[model samples]
Target: MAFPFTPSRPLWLLGCGNMAGAMLSRWLESGLDPAAVTIVDPMRTDAPEGVRLCAVPPADEPAPAALLIGIKPQIFIETAGTIDALTGPETVVISIMAGIDGATLGDRFARAGGIVRLMPNLPAALGQGASILHICRDGANAHDVADALARPLGLALWVDREALIDAGTAVSGSGPAFVYRFIDAIAKGAEKLGFAPDQAAALALATVGGAAALAAASDVSPATLADRVASPGGTTRAGLNILDADQSIDSLVARTLQAASDRAVELAEMARN
Candidate 1:
């Protein structure tokens, strides 16, 4: 679905790195006007045709209708002054920087129309990402605008509480790396079982991809699918038993997310100070 409301004023994007780049590319591909967008990134070499690229915030232009801050959280303070002039009471500030809370953003951009904290994973580059949004204000229009921006990127969801964004960071933002590690572990296991290194890696990758695709398309729970795959006394069941024994995998995953979430909180504290 398209954005419900097309921004009337210019949209300024600060720091067009990987995450921001993916989002912008998706927005442009979804028919957002390139002429209405300006990217401010010193290191970025180019932008989609018709979009303007600049090393610094524009001084001549009026305050933007929407400003997206895509810079790292650690450098936000250093970069805030440059983009401060571009925000006003009419400008919606959407930040994709992890660990930065809405309260901090609200304080930083006190005059902004609204503040939205969004967490989008690397899969966004492929338009198959999961974007979690948390807006400072309570209203349908704010959600609509954020949703519209997230739709082209991938699965878009909004949480009632801002704290949930950090939880989402643990599950989605840091999820890709965990999934990659699992895939690598699977490949290593296969290699130990006699498969060639390269062959094992390829098969492991494809298996995980296919399973994920199937799960995405299926109506039944993955548990049910696992039962179907493992008939009585089957090889799959044998392996699953080891992984499921004493809920080892479940506990490990919980701890993993907990660690990530804790770190997010630490980052938030750092940003606050």
Candidate 2:
């Protein structure tokens, strides 16, 4: 579907690496006008048809309506000065870099209209990603612009407090990797049960995919669905018993998320320093 909201000025992408490239590709596929987009990435070789690609910002162009920052957090401070000229009081800044807080972005791009921190996973390349947004200021236009840009990428959610963003980073931003690990473990378990390597991998992947699809389509909670599947005294219940015993699975997952969230806080502190 086409993005319904239009920005007052053109949009500029500060970097076009993997994450930014995914977002750009999805935006173009969703009917965004390529002519309205500009990319500034020294390493990028090209851009979508009708889109302009430049190693540096154009000297004469006016500040863009929205500037999406997709550079690495480690180099953001070093690179912030270089892009300062592109931000103005009317320009909105959106960042997808992990750990950099909205306050820091606001300080770096002080003249921009607003700042938004977005955490998106790698799945965005397939347009099935989950994104969490945290706006630094209160403005309908800024929020609308962000929503417009995020909707095509997949599930888009907004948090009231910026601190919650770290929690989101742990859950949604780092979630795909955890899911992938789970899938790999399942495949290994199947192989251990005598299934051929290739067959085990396929079965594990299909089982996860089908279960996720079913959960998405169903009205009941996943726990309810799980209960429904584990018929009284059945094999499914036998496996679930092990997983639920002493809440082992739950504790493991909680610890994993905590570690990720803690790291996000550390990164934010690093950015501040």
Candidate 3:
């Protein structure tokens, strides 16, 4: 399929770290023209062929139509002056940095046409991700442009309140790591149950992948699916009994999400300060 949106001007990626690189790769694979992109990163040596790479924003070119800020949050202060120079009244600023709030972005890029904060997971590298967006302000078609950019990477979910982005950061942004931990735990359990380590790892990975796919395809709730799988007095039921006893799993996961969300809030506070 052709790229969903084409800007009148080129899109500039401010930092090309792993997450930004993954996003750029997906966008290129989805038919975005490499010529229409520019990356400003001194350390990025692997920019896709045909895209412009510069240590600093080009001096002669007009301000970019869109700017994706993928730099480390701690370095934002050092980079803000340079980035601000490249931002014009019609440039849409999309930021993936955690902890930085819309207000701070607006303050830093006062001339930007619009501001958006996005949180995307590692799965975005494969075009299957949950991207949570908060459109802080819409100027010069920012909302539509941001949506178009997000859809190619995964499910583009928007929240009415920017605060919800922090919650989403805790859930989808940090969720993959939690899932990985659970998969490893399953593999360890399998190894303890007499399976070879490689076999246990493969089984755990496939089991989780298949179950998640099934859950997505099914119309019924996952809890209902679990019930359907666990025939009365069966092995699955016995396992479910242990997991459900005292609601231990539910409580544990709740605490985990809460901790992540709290950290996101802290990061935001630090950025503002």
Candidate 4:
């Protein structure tokens, strides 16, 4: 289904980099009209076919039904004043820029109908993303509008507490890079075990992909699935034993997430200033 865009005004995207480009692609695939969207990006390298691209927000145009802030947090601060004109009392301001919380957005776009903070992961480019959103003020049908925009990208999750948006950033937003590292680690292990480099890479990627698909389809928890794989004293059991020993993997992942979450908090502070 196509996104149900407001007929009166277009959707204004303040940036069109990697994450924003991915979202636009997904929305287009969902039947969003390219003509109904306007992109204001200094670097317009990734714009899809038929979408409007502008170096700056256009002057003398109607306020957009929604304004999506898709730039980096630092860039958003630099350009916030410039794009402030794009939002109005009927516009739902949806921001995907990390580190900037709802209060900051509310303060910046005081005339906006509502403010929404969205955290979307890399997989969103492929319509397989997990988007975490926090709606600060549900004015002008903001909740439904945010849902409509997120639904086309992937799984949409609404968090009641704005702080959880940062937590989700660590888990789902930065999670893909972590998973990629794990896959590479497995590939390196395979190489050490005598597999060719190309073969190892392919095997590692396919194995992880298939395993994730299985886990998603399974009714049981992933822990149960892991147990089902290890027969007593078998090779799988041996490998599992090493991973489970002293909970090293768990501790490492915990520290990894904590670091990402902490950085997100720092960004928020920077945005506030």
List runs of model 4 lying over 4 Å from the truth.
none
In model 1, how large is the Cα lDDT of residue 46? Answer: 86
Q: In model 2, what is the error at residue 178, expressed in angstroms?
A: 0.6
Which of the two candidates, 1 or 2, achieves a greater TM-score against the reference?
Answer: 2
lDDT of 1: 0.84
Clashes of each: 0, 0, 0, 0
RMSD of each: 2.0, 1.9, 1.4, 1.2
TM-score of 2: 0.94
**Model with the higher lDDT, candidate 1 or 2:** 2
Instruction: Tell me the lDDT of model 2 at 23.
Output: 92
State the C-alpha lDDT per candidate: 0.84, 0.87, 0.89, 0.88
lDDT of 4 by residue, 1-273 (tens): 756574467898988888888898888888888888889987875467778889878888888988889988887788777667678888889999888988888777877898899899878878889999999877978998889999877899999999999999999999999999999999999999999999999999999999999999999998899999999999999999888999988989999999999999999999998
If the candidates were sorted by their TM-score against the true structure, best first, what order would they fall in? 4, 3, 2, 1
Candidate 3 per-residue C-alpha lDDT over 1-273 given as tens digits, one digit per residue, 9 for 90 to 100: 455335458889999988888888888988899988999998877678888899878898888888999999889966787788898888889999988888888888878899999999888888988999998878968888788788889889989899889999889999999999999999999999999999999999999999999999999999999999999999999999999999999999999999999998898888888
Evaluated with TM-score, which candidate comes out highest? 4
Clashing pairs in 2: none
Q: In candidate 2, what are the lDDT values of residues 107-201, reduced to their tens digit?
A: 77756777888888778877889999989964436788888889889999998899989999999999999999999999999999999999999
Ranking by lDDT: 3, 4, 2, 1
Model 3 worst lDDT run, 10 consecutive residues: 1-10
Worst 10 residues of 1 by lDDT: 1-10
